[model samples]
Target: MFNKGNKGLFALVLTLFMLTNFVSNAQEGESIFNSKCATCHAPHKDMTGPKLFEVRQKWEEGGAMEGSLHQWVKNWQVAAATDPYAKEVSDWAPSAMTLFADLTDEQIEAVFDYVDEQPKGGAVADAAGAAGGGVASNIATEENDFGWIWYILGAVFLVIIFSVGGVKRQLQELDEDADKQVKVGSKVWVFKNRKYVGIGVLVLVMAGVVWLFLGLYQIGVVSSYQPSQPIAFPHDIHAGINGIDCKYCHNSADKSKSAGIPTTNVCMNCHKQIQGAGDQVEKIKNIYASAGFSPEGGGKYSGETEPIIWNKVHNLPDHVYFNHSQHVEIGGIDCKQCHGDMTKQNELPRVVPVEELNMVEGNIQLTRPTLTMGWCIECHNVKEVSTGTLEGKGGYYDEIHKRLLENDESLYEEYLEDGKVTVNELGGWECAKCHY
Candidate 1:
């Protein structure tokens, strides 16, 4: 009886301990989720990553979720095998997620537990609706923006009216003074008031010189110059409508100085199978012919290939050094931020006048930022850097955070409070960041 009682007491204590641990883990999972996973994934809604609630179900049904989740979180390729779900998810988001092998088991459990408890309907619908609404609003705003054009037209009309009135008044004054003995002839007027005439001539000469220099300074600047491309590469179709990643075609943006143009082979990789381009197939066939291939059927040719030479519309001067990777990959700037909506244009349009003067310059297109250096400075000044530990978004900012910690310990401490650091605070505006 005594031994049995002792055994029962021990079992009771063990059960209580397990229950406490489970509850503690659940809370910790909530905290971990809010910090890391919340940025890209939600329990029931899709953002950059898929909805977590459905992921488990999909994984189990597809025979992928259970074993692959852990491996996928650690290394993408490891989970890719025998994990159809993982492959599908990765396809949806071409960018690889940052590895999270550092996360503790307790943290992972907490994340899963939190995901299990998320209320489903509201979150998913709200996110989808908001995304759709945002796109519609953006289109509506662009369509309705005639205010600036109207304002300029009105100002021009006012200037013309004032100039006509001034000319009429001057004629009236001349007629009233006609009877005076002083002649209106140029030689007589100059002789009568030689000092006034001389001053006026000097003023005119100085103004003309200033105007000439200013005009010369602005000669080579082409802000809104839309040139026709060899192949009407529609940015709107590739980027906006089809949702092809900017990095997909311009693969070098992340790895090299130039966002290298896509090779003809890259085009053939997709086009070989998709030969008929819905009336665009004929245009695509020309590309295949240039690359020495028969699109109607597989006809192998001698290994000779000639690439289509695209006219580079945006050429910067040799003196300035600008790396596309640094801005797009490291700084996390969207291609659309600079290139605008490429999909909307049938052919790549000259970057709007606003962006041209603001961001480009020179026959070599030096980094003067035609808009104003102050505008570039302002973006660098106000934008914040992401901290690696932030939820959902991958931790690309860790290296930057370390640099900040080394230089400004006090600022680093403040950033720790919010778990983020802004780009401005981290020396983003330094001339060397872009100019050098």
Candidate 2:
């Protein structure tokens, strides 16, 4: 009886240990989903991919869950061959999901376990709600600037001071001339004075030179240059309120040079279902009209579709080469870093103020930075490349870092002491990186 009790106690302890391991693995899977899949997929909602909440159920009921799940995760193409279940999921999402063949069997199992435990409707709604809040906050912060009021007040004060000084000077001159009772300093006499004439000419020449240099510096630069857009699109509604991902609208940043404008078909994907106008919807409808789409009835016309001619806001000189991918993909710079909170802008306004002196000017005023070569180098020198993580995956810089640590002991020790290698240290300031 004592032996039986001992065996039972041991079995209970082993069961508890296994359960704890399973829970830990499931939590890690959630982290993985948050980092990578959350951008495109959701547990319940049919987003870029199928509703993942019922993925396990679909796979299990179809009789290919275990083996197909393993293979589909490793390589979709390989798994899709014999796996009818995998094919069904793929058919739902026409766009091929990027394969994560590198993940181990254990990791894939953890992901499945996480999918099984996810609460229906709750996870998707919560994620969408959080994203909406972030967009709204960003828009609000941008719109609340008091810089323009201050600028007008300063100009008014300067004008008042100048007018007062001019009146006082005129009165003093009149009194002096009356007391003297003589022709006080004729215009010709003043002009003939070598000292005064020399000073006048010197001032004019200096002003001309400064003006010429300023014009040359501003030659190709366009600051505060808001042009009329085809669609009077309000970022506040789409990005801020609706909570669309910037990447969704500007999809090419991940894989290509340009964040190419969304095609008309992309617009129809959502706009077709939602035709009712709420102030900004008419603007969105204009985009449809330009693409030869009639919202009244009938489907898209087969005739020549005139693409909406959007005036590009951020224009770089032909000589300069700027790649959206390099900054976005490699450096992981946010779109808001350069473009400001576009969600707050109600109308497309011309950019002004050639040089940005502060965050107010740089972000709100839509001013171009004094983008001299030195200024570019200075930014690169200060900015640190976060070798911490890549799009929520493990840091891609880790391999290079490991090599540096193992091969160069002194350099590794110094880097550890400093806590980081700045962009400049990693040759980010090199001319070729930007110029080429």
Candidate 3:
């Protein structure tokens, strides 16, 4: 009974309706996954939880009870208690999954539906990366060209000045009478001022020697070396504005020598909701892309990821032996004592110069190059070995202090001549301490 045009309109309406419903479900699923599931489950990769790609089909094939996977998502402990398959899955990750008793069966199904659609290779931001690369290349080219142009101009000017001077000299020489007067009189005039000339030469020689030593001192001293990071992660915003602790991200500082860079997942802990604006949006998008995430339409994992290649800002030679835990956990030294106050830092951290570091409120003033042997030795000589720090985590420092006071009282007194038992007294200056 319907006309052809009406029938066509009905089909179009139906198609749009289905698409709208599908997109809405996916968005809802993405929101739920990012909020509750992302901390553990990755779409294709095994994390704290097994990969959720085709997970429902896998569960069915694995002989899981009908609808048991949904129940597991709702409340894992209950599912583990009731079903043999769920119990086996729970053992895969030692850390227990949080109970999501509020999640409906339909919601769990939607999450699975969303996850199954994730592309295996993930979202490649080749366009964005290529654009950035092109911009970087153009800027580099411009900088090189700018420098070469100035150099060329300088050379041209130098040639012109010398040519003009030589021509002027030739013209003067053509006046033979003036040239003879100049040659004969000039030596006598110089001979009269020979004492003043000698004194001037001596002053110039001393100045050159002083300058040479100063320049030599700066050869290996790389202070304020600020390398560009892939992301301009403002420490002032995270640490000062938001009050996120340094240890929260650089979790290894108290455990290892390197303050480890936080993985992209760590950045997504808050960034899942905090999609930034302007220039930062591009940088944060790079994080999302690396974490296999789409930060649009509520967000979903794409299963593709690439690591952010960060340039090292602080580098120590292979021969040097440094342990962060020794200073951080045992000595109870504040991070600001070495790395300047991050709360005030607007850009990525660089090696703060000795002069600038002294300007900081509480840092011990040192006169040597940053991170040099002299700097370490100077800090050891000056920093007080207090009772609280000496009675550290292992009580080894306390025992050492006690032995110094009891067994080697005279040596202890001599060390305490400056009114404190500094690191220098505790065998900090031993060659084997750092070298080997």
Q: Which predicted model would earn the best lDDT?
A: 3
- The runs of at least 3 residues in candidate 3 whose Cα sits more than 4 Å from the true structure, single-residue gaps closed, are 1-186, 388-390
- Per-residue lDDT tens digits of candidate 3, residues 264-360? 8899999999998888788788899889999778899999987775645665543467888778877677888788888989987788777777878
lDDT per residue for candidate 2 within 27-109, as digits (tens), equals 45654454345545666666666656657667888887567877876678778877777777778776755566557788776
Model 1 / residue 188 / CA error / Å = 3.9
Each candidate's TM vs. the true structure? 0.46, 0.48, 0.56
Which residue pairs clash in candidate 3? 122-304
Winner by TM-score between candidate 3 and candidate 2: 3
What local distance difference test score does each model get?
0.56, 0.56, 0.66
| lDDT minimum window of 10 residues, candidate 2 | 133-142
lDDT of 3 at 133: 19
**What's model 2's TM-score?**
0.48
For every candidate, C-alpha RMSD to the true structure in Å: 33.7, 32.3, 24.9
| Candidate 3 structure, TM-score to reference | 0.56
- Could you arrange the candidates by lDDT from highest to lowest? 3, 1, 2
TM-score of model number 1: 0.46
CA lDDT, candidate 1, residue 265: 84
lDDT of 1 by residue, 1-436 (tens): 3232223334433443443354455445643454345545656666777777756566777767666877775566667766787887688877655456556665666678666865555442344334431122222222222333355335434543443344345445555676774765653454456457446544543554354335333423445645434566667766777788878888999878998888988887777776654868767867777688775546554566666756445544322457776667666766655665455656565645544433433211224443344435666654544644444243556666666667887878886665555666666666676563
Ranked by TM-score, top first: 3, 2, 1
